[model samples]
Target: MNRYKHRAYNEELMDDLTAGGPSMDQTLRELETINRWLGGNFVTIDGLVKLLKKSPSRPLVIADLGCGGGDILKLVARWASKKKLEVELVGFDANPHIIEYAKENCKEFKNIRFEVQDIFSEEFKQREFDIILCTLFTHHFTEKQLTGIFRQFKSQAKIGVVINDLHRHPLAYHSIKLLVNLFSKSEMVKNDGPLSVLRAFKRKELVQLMNDAEIDRFTLQWMWAFRWQLVF
Candidate 1:
């Protein structure tokens, strides 16, 4: 087994600053599919279900950070609708094109909307959300950045924060490496899929980061398909 336990900051093709086109859109679509099949969406859904329990009577306002295709937000919106719960869902992403794509894809859901936002900006810090959900997003940041981000999340979220992200392990890395190479059509997917695993966290690493962020009231659970479901 490979024994290294440090985060790798390799550049993912999908993170290309100047990249925006049909291929970028295709890659995002593929990522949504992967999340669906790998049960990545369920991780956040489960956390949301728990968070919803805290304030059952109030109208809920939820925000999904780094919402590429807004798939998770759409799923949450549908779940809330089916339960007859009054809820508003918002999706945030820094890329304008991705935000446009998310809006177009989620146009059928009136309760869900998209916004272009830098999560670290003063505007984001000023806004308050009942529940903030992050899926497969935290791995993109360094530990120092994550500490600051988590602290902000604690300050801005009124109810709680749900973080669903990859677990870095030799098995996870190799399994995704094989699966993406075989099933993905986009070059960005073929490159970034495994790279994300390398950038992902170990359980201890997340625990330490949370400690550094000064967030104490939280539970971290290991979910299926190598995901960390953290609720704060």
Candidate 2:
């Protein structure tokens, strides 16, 4: 199948698979497992930290686009706190349920705020965020949608945008299946995990997509088994 066709198939399949509502606990646990598997080597977080350390004069404002349940936002918050940097975090997700959960679960962090807004919508201010970070997301888009999203990111971000996502490979697909079976009992996870890996973009594919989106001045890096990063 072509890339777009495969992406559509994966999207439909995932929606069907996860239709029954995987509990917050199950979703968080699966995310934790995935994070551990990725070795907490989120290049976006590390890259933002590097940027902040280099420029000590300004406080950083970061938006976690598609921040489901705020797991990665919490990590970003914790990392920022550890680095003793002043960071204003905004977690944006299309899912209202996830936004509510994030607000309640991550209430301890005063600097982090959750908002229900579509990343593609014009509701958010343009060029307001210092860095826009997306994690374990973006595979849901085709090249056209990706280009549109990048345009929005470019308009909404002042310094740069960071994208972290899975790299599709047969090995990664099998690994996800094995790991999900080993760690989770949710049928939604068991089905969606492997499909997500299959739907993920390869490193070169992502680079080409970035190029097609006219995002030329960015650094591409890989981590652990399948995670890839595009830092601008």
Candidate 3:
């Protein structure tokens, strides 16, 4: 596999689910496990912490774009509760079933709500959010699409945006392949995990994309377990 070139987008099987079947739900739960153990949640929380330090206000509204299983937002809700900070966490997803799954998982947290909306649609563009989060979400798009998304994030986010995504590299790819094979039972997780690494970004490639998006006020850092923490 040529690590230098960006691979074509492969649709994740979980993205196509229309109903909450066992396999689909298992895949999402497995993904939440993978993210939690692999430092995915920490990276976004780090960015969120920085944002909170800058703007110490009550009732902070945060939107998790493409929130899968709503794990990250739920985690955020718990953290906010510990800090005694009032927050409204909204999860936006294109799939209704997925939204339902997330809502079920996060039902205990009254501060979190799930909404089914396409990110590229007019409603998403018109709506404003205090902080926009893209956690393990951006790699699915093409460079052009990412550029536009970044532009939209810049315009719509009042405080800023936090993106925690994969870093494509040979070591990261092979390590995840081995782990997925050993631990994952779901076919969707087995197939899409390594493919996600292929679809991920290099440091310079992300910088160029940010430049193309005309977004400069950002910090991109490589976090542990092959993730990029981009705070804008």
Q: Which stretches of candidate 1 lie over 4 Å from their true place?
A: 1-3
Give the winner by lDDT: 1 or 3: 1
Estimate TM-scores for all models: 0.96, 0.88, 0.96
Q: lDDT (CA) for every model shown?
A: 0.89, 0.74, 0.88
Candidate 3, residues 1-232, lDDT tens digits: the string is: 5653775487866557474677778988999999888877899999999877854656888999899899999989988888888899999999888888898999898999999999999878999998999998999899999999999988899999999999998888899999999999888889889889988988999999999999888899999989999999
User: What does candidate 1's lDDT look like per residue over 57-146, in tens digits?
Assistant: 878899999999889988998888888889999999888888888998899999999998898889889999989999999999999999
- How close to the true structure is residue 211 of candidate 2, measured as C-alpha lDDT? 86
- Candidate achieving the largest lDDT: 1
| TM-score of model 2 vs. true structure | 0.88
* Tens-digit per-residue lDDT, 1-232, candidate 2: 5442344345623333233245644665676667766674466677676555475567888898878768787888888788787889999876676777778778999999988776666667443788888887788777888888887777778888888887777777787788888988666677777877767776778878778878888888777667787786
lDDT of 3: 0.88
Q: Locate the minimum summed-lDDT window of 10 residues in model 1.
A: 11-20
Off by over 4 Å in 2: 1-8, 12-24, 125-127
Looking at model 2, residue 171 earns an lDDT score of 78
